[model samples]
Target: MSRITALTPDQVPAESKSTLDAFTKNIGFTPNMMTAFAKSPIAFNAWATLLGSMSKALDVKTRDSIGLAVSEVNGCNYCLTVHSFTAEHMAKLPADEIILARKGHATEPKRDAAVQFAKKVIETRGNVGDADLKAVRDAGYTDANIMEIVALVAMYSLTNFFNNVFDHEKDFPAVTPAGAI
Candidate 1:
C-alpha cells in the first residue's frame, strides 16, 4: 500500500490522460509512480520531458546502468525493480551485467566509469573530487557526457526518493537489492 493514495485511472487529470492511456496500452498498465505524478501535472510533464530529452543522450544501456546504481544507493525497491526490468528488456543487458550494474560496475570500461561516477555523486552528494572528473574524462567521456551522467543520476535519484517516500506499491517484477535478505 502507498503512503499517499494514487488517483485511480478515471481520476487522472486531462493533461496526462492520453499519455497515461498510451502507457497502459503499451505496458498493460500505468505505472504507480506515474499515477502518483498525475496528481501534479507540472511534475508529471517535467519528468516526461526530462525522460524524452534523455532519449537523445546516452545509450539506454548506460542510462540503465546509472539508474540501477542510483536505485541501489538510495535503497529504493520500486526503482530497483523498475530499472531491473528495463535493463534486461529495454536495454538488452546481460543478466551478469545487470548484477554488476547494481553494484555500480560494468564490464565495459566507459560505462563502468559513468556508473562509478554516478555512485560517487550520490555518495558525496555532488561533491565529487577533481580526480573523479578526470577519471571519467580519461575514459573518453566529454564534458557533455558528464553532464548527462549527472542528469541521469539526478533523474533516477528523483524517482528513487519519490517512490521511497510515497511507498509506491511495486508494479513491475520485484527485484531485491543485492544485500537485502
Candidate 2:
C-alpha cells in the first residue's frame, strides 16, 4: 500500500479538479477520505454518486438504522464517526436510540426492523432471503423503501471497505478523541 498522503489542491489530478472544487465550496474543505479517493476520479465519482443517490432515496429512519448496522459490521472508523453523527444530528435520532440500534436492540418497531434487515443484507451479500424481506415488509416498509436500503448498504459498504483498505483517516478533527468512528 502506498503511504496515504493528505491531498492538497496541488496534488489533485485534472479529473478531480471540478468535483473537489465544488466539494470544497460546499463543505469548506474537501473531505480527506474523498481527497484520497480522488486519486482515481472514476472511483471517487462512483462513491460520490452512490452515496448521494442512496442518501436521497433513504428514509431518515431507515438511513440511521442502516448506517449503524453497516458501520458496526464493517468496523469502519471513518464511517462510524460520520454516520453516527448524521444519525444523531441530521436524522434527529436520539443518542440512546442509535446506541440501541448499534447493539441490535433498537425498540422502535420500524427502526428495529430497519437495522435487522440491514444486518441481514450485509451478512447475506444481497441473497437476503424472503423471510428477511417479509419481516421488513411487515415492519411497514414498502418494497421501494426496502430497495433504498439495498442501495444504502451497497454504497456504505463501498466506502466502508475502502476506508479500511486504504487506511483513510477521519475527516472531521472535532470528533477524534471520542473514538466514535
Candidate 3:
C-alpha cells in the first residue's frame, strides 16, 4: 500500500485537475506518480512544467536512459518500471539496451557517456569531478547537452525520491532490477 493516497482526477485539488486530465488525454491514463503528486497542487504543477520543458531538451532515448540510470541507482522500483516501459515502447530502445541503461551503460558510445554521467551525478550528489565533465564532452556532447543531462538527473531524482518515500503502487508493467530473481 502507498503511504500517500493516489488521488483521482476529480479528487485532486482544482488546480491539479486540469493537469491530470491532460495526462489522461495524452497518455490514455494518468500515471500513478502524477496522481500521487496531485495530493499537492504546487508539486504537481512544478513537476508537469519541468517535465514538459525537459522533454524538448533531449531525444527520447537519452531522456529515458537518464531516467533509468538514476532510478536504478536510487533503487526506486516505481520509476524503474515506468521508465522501462517508456524506454522500450515510447523511446524504441531495444530490450537489451534498456537493461544496459538500467545498469548505467549503453552500447552506443555517446549514449553511454550520458548514462554514466547521470549515474555519477546521483552517486556524487552532483559534485562531479572535472574528469567526469570531460568524459561527457569528449563523447561529443555540447555544454548545452551537459546542462540538459544535469537537469534530467535532477528531474528524475525528484520523482525517484518521491516514489521511494511513498512506495506508490506501480501502475505500469513491473520491471525487476538487473540481477533480481
Q: How well does candidate 2 match the true structure in TM-score terms?
A: 0.82
Residue 36 local lDDT, model 1? 88
Candidate 3 lDDT by residue in tens digits, 94-174:
989988898899998999999999899998998999999999999999999999999999999899899999988878898
Give candidates' CA RMSD values in order.
1.5, 3.2, 1.6
Alpha-carbon local distance difference test for all models = 0.87, 0.75, 0.88
Query: TM-scores of the models, in the given order?
Result: 0.94, 0.82, 0.94
Worst 10 residues of 1 by lDDT: 172-181
| Candidate 2 global CA lDDT score | 0.75
- Candidate 2 Cα misplacement greater than 4 A, ranges: 1-3, 25-28, 173-181
lDDT of 1 by residue, 27-83 (tens): 676789888877888787788788879878889999999999989989898888889
Candidate scoring better on TM-score of 1 and 2: 1
Q: Please report, as a residue range, the 10-residue window in candidate 3 with the lowest summed lDDT.
A: 172-181
Q: Can you give the lDDT of residue 122 in candidate 3?
A: 90
Candidate 2 lDDT for residue 35: 83
lDDT of 2 by residue, 52-144 (tens): 677677578677767777877777767776777777767888877776666654677877887898888887788888998999899898888
